[model samples]
Target chain A: MTTRILTPEELALLSLVQDELVPSYGDLPPAGTLGAALTVDAYLAEQPRLRRPVLTTLRAIEVRAGKAPFAELDAGRRVEVLRKVENADPESFSELVKQTYNAYYTRPDIQASLGIDNPPQPLGFELPAFDESRLSRVRAMGKLWRDD
Target chain B: MAAPELDSDVLIVGSGASGAAAAWSLSRGGLRVTCLEQGRWVDPSEYAHSRPDYELARQTSFAKDPNVRGWAADYPINNSGTPIYPLMVNAVGGSTVHWSGHFPRMRPSDFRVRTLDGVADDWPFTYWDLEPYYDLNDSMVGVSGLAGDPANPPRSPRQTPPLAFDAGCEAYLRGLENLGWHWWPCDNALISEPFGENRSPCNCCGPCDIGCPIGAMSSAHVTYWPKALAQGVQLITHARVEQITVDHAGQATGALYYDDHGVRRSHTAGVVVMAANGVGTPRLLLNSTSARFPNGLANNSGVVGAYLMFHPVAFVSGVFEEVVNGQRGPIGGLMNCQEFYETDLARGFVRGFELQLSRSVGPLSVANGGILGHPVPWGSEHHEALRSRYAHTMTTSVMLEDLPEPENRVTLDPELTDAHGIPAPRVEYRAGENTQRMLEFSIARARELFEAAGAVEILVDPLVQESGWHLMGTCRMGDDPERSVINGWGQAHECSNLFVIDGSTFTTSAAVNPTSTIQAVALRCADWLGRNYRDVAA
Candidate 1:
């Protein structure tokens, strides 16, 4: 369980990947620096079983980012390509987005540095932001449809 | 590494409700009880936050072994008529840790089913006999409910009040009421408010099927193990019991088992309690071949693993207009109807079902429905469907009680050892004709109720007549040694000091959840062991 390092090039590619996936407002740091700081390569190296799937998923993300052969795309084109993929299949993009997010969120250094909000809470206790107006309207409509 | 040899006054196998309860009871009695649990203790606080971390990918659903590498079933959902079905949980607290916590005591008539209704065999003990122990078990586990339901026997005062039913739940209630069925609040083993020392109130997050993070649900880890530890019970986790050892005089000696690290060890005790659940209990006994008892340990009657039973559960789901945050709270949040419990010759089914009401839906479930055409009227139909339907829908799940038959039994496979190299419990089971009829009736009733509730579209999932969870009847209780595995007091007929306290000892499958009754019997057995230890030892 020792710390390991990710190559700078791989870190930059991972960052370029994350920048395209998450909503800009969702409080995430740039992926490259976070990936570098996380020792992503070392973690993956230890998990030999997950290596193939992880690589395949990253390659899929790169292709979706229009970085054919992955190594070619700049950061801007990667974002544009990801937006297209996200629009086409949000389900497939979700895993990549979540992985990139967790990659940063799980690292203690990145977590503290970014002030990410992933504190411990009881199971099923996470509250969604309440939009009273939306909820009230929904409730009113539901009342109308009541079989009672 | 050399495995440590262990010895104790009591060697209890399996750490679910039964083992945990026995451990607590024996430990409190000043006995050197050693509990051998195959699964390791997983701290609740480890993944308390981040509910998604404990999903299927995490593989920690309902106290089953997280490390189980392959699917137990050779194939998925058997649509063909296969009599055999598998049910099991291999975890620290066994299945009890992850159960829905629906704690209903078996009714008085449930025990004397053969004598009263002549369908199943009569249990050696009656509900009146188990009443006090049931109360004690309920109090220990902290059940929350209201009494005075005319259908059920009067219950002792619950530790807490029933959970509040949500707004959408009334629709289903009305439908059940319209059909002239009586419904009552379910007896839940969850803390509605603060109870005895260290226990906290349930916040009703609705994901009790997954491990409860706050310890509000009555898993054995929270309920019995704590008391057992306080009373000096020695719990040996990851020690899988292989066989029960008996001496030349037909007396119980102890057991042989392997630790998590796969080193074999032996423990000697005056009494051996096989609380290894319905499946595990019989498997261990059958595997314990010896010169004195070659068939199996205490298999004098050749009925070590016969008459297995589990209630066939069918789930129903629908779409409503408002967001019913169904993803929170313990399973079976509400119990709407049980008027069908009585046997009606006219209904063409021997046993009736108890309707469990719940509305907890997770994101995966929501996403599942959205693709299944449950949502919007869309395009032009969008606003109309979204405005009118989603929040108003609520579903009632029926747990149909199945009759116990000898053909449905447990036996060992020549193949399949567990991760620790112990043979896995091979279950041979099938739903009886009576149970099949009950499922058909229950499904039709469910559809009727939904239609009456003005459901625009109601989808009925195929009936799965078997679940491995509520396993019972393999080592059933009765009066005659030739016919039964255990006596009325839960003592083995062949071995006086040996006992089976879990669902394996149940003679009949009650229409409700079995955890409360299992805990109750464990407590009663422990009490009996405390009084009669000297007589048996001599």
Candidate 2:
């Protein structure tokens, strides 16, 4: 498929949301893949009939992008929004911005397409190739996330 | 969410051994059975062909997104920080997709562990009561083992030969004999030779914990699911049951659930079987609050989510000179030391434990744990430790039987909810004194076994997180309705048409794995339904 150049409005808004989500994102689009980050296919698979919720989540992110120059925001502000809207719900405008950013970048299909085999392991972590030093470090980092 | 309209003769929840067996039996009995599974059907060939991949799936891979449900996060069972816990499979086959296939029957003593030992409550039925169904399940699944052992209850001859043991098994035998402990080859569900069914002989790929790629392990996927499907069982996957609606008269009419599309759907059936597993089943029942039964569905005895138990596991490993080749066969191999299965007068623990002489470490597991006495930082020392431990390590797992304490229960957290906004099951559990004492005894025995095997260095996993894996007793079966959730026949005490045929019905946590017994009970329950309700049609 031919790469379509995003409209100026789309480009600016996408860049703002990307910056809000992942502050370190460079010149490229915020998504892990160059294409649309949140596809209808993936959304429908989990949320089936929740198109309104999806749209609402996306629109909130867009609204933040519409007002603020998200890319120019400080790292702390970017993180604030990201944490807020990380889920399908946005607790704040900053969260909306962050959620939109993450939603765009964290697409499974996009990651696969990008040949990025890096997926989060269960219990919020991953076991990489067996390296004694790394394993010891992680083991020593005991109870980083408390079950309580 | 609104409840969708659904109509069926029989609606079976879950897809594990009991669920699958019930579906198979019910479908064969000519009922229009609709089986609802929260997990999709995983093609074993696609995901679990190689040993490396299988290990990866078990040790590392997250469950598929849709299969990863709310209960996992809501109830934190594995507080040990390890990712592993009482992992319920979401796909059509359920946990049977990844079981060790050690299908031992509940010994005659096992049924009455409570009465004989004076610890817990006795099962309403006896071994003879469940023997025919055990025989049926064993025959249908092609159980393999040596049957002459006097330790276990007498049964019909195994349909297939026993699985071959490794050098580690030989050492275990010698060590156990030295300790004067009786050992018998495990009665597993694997076919040792070409059998009457579609199953093939065991190639011994040791990755049965994740799943058996080939047709070696007799999972419900190969055993009953296909048969059920062929008999016209309508299976709907990715369906998460939320509530069971009952009439004013207290008879179950149907259930409300989330379909694959996350759309609220409802299914009405003449009979509803809750096989959603110990945690899921109780959670659903507790969440199904109507004006008539506000506490939960069929919880008139106020015991829908009480008396939970799990086998407390303690691991001990030692480094040997020889290569054990642990990644070659079934996850559990050789014999189990059942000397501790029954309570001993000299023992501190009221209940007992079973020493499963299972396989040693695979290369990957050894690599993960640096060699014994070599806890160096992860550079050169780490590599050396992995190399030293890779071939020399052997492990023995102690499955300590837990007593069903009323305090150890499954309840719904008022604050927490699943992705679909349904209340999540909150688990409140603590290891009873009997289990802790059993662990202490097993730890001591494990140390002795390692020394007997001439191990240079032995390492035992610190007892930390207690799991709810062998989940049972949520809806226990007994003679009195006031005491138990289900009747002796596995039917709900309040609702006759509703049956609970999973680990939830276990009255006591026997030292043996409960999957096989659960399957037997499920098959028997199905037979009862068939003989009783033959006139019901699709």
Cα lDDT tens digits, model 1, B291-406, are 87788887878888888787777656554444454444454667646667768879997757877776644332232242122323112232234324333445566777778787
The models' CA-based lDDT, in order, is: 0.65, 0.66
DockQ of 2: 0.02
Give the per-residue lDDT digits (tens) of candidate 2, residues B4-117. 343777889888888899999988867778888877777645553342223334332433211333323222222232222455665677777766787776677778876677
Q: Chain A only: list TM-scores of all candidates.
A: 0.45, 0.33
Alpha-carbon TM-score of each model against the true structure: 0.76, 0.74
Model 1, C-alpha of B384: deviation from truth (Å): 13
Error of 1 at B79 (Å): 14
**DockQ of predictions, in order shown:** 0.08, 0.02
Could you give the interface RMSD of each candidate, to one decimal? 12.9, 18.5
lDDT by residue (A1-148, candidate 2, tens digit) is: 3213333444455444543333322243433234332332233345444344544554555555445755566656655544445443633333233223225434444334333243321111111111122123223322211011
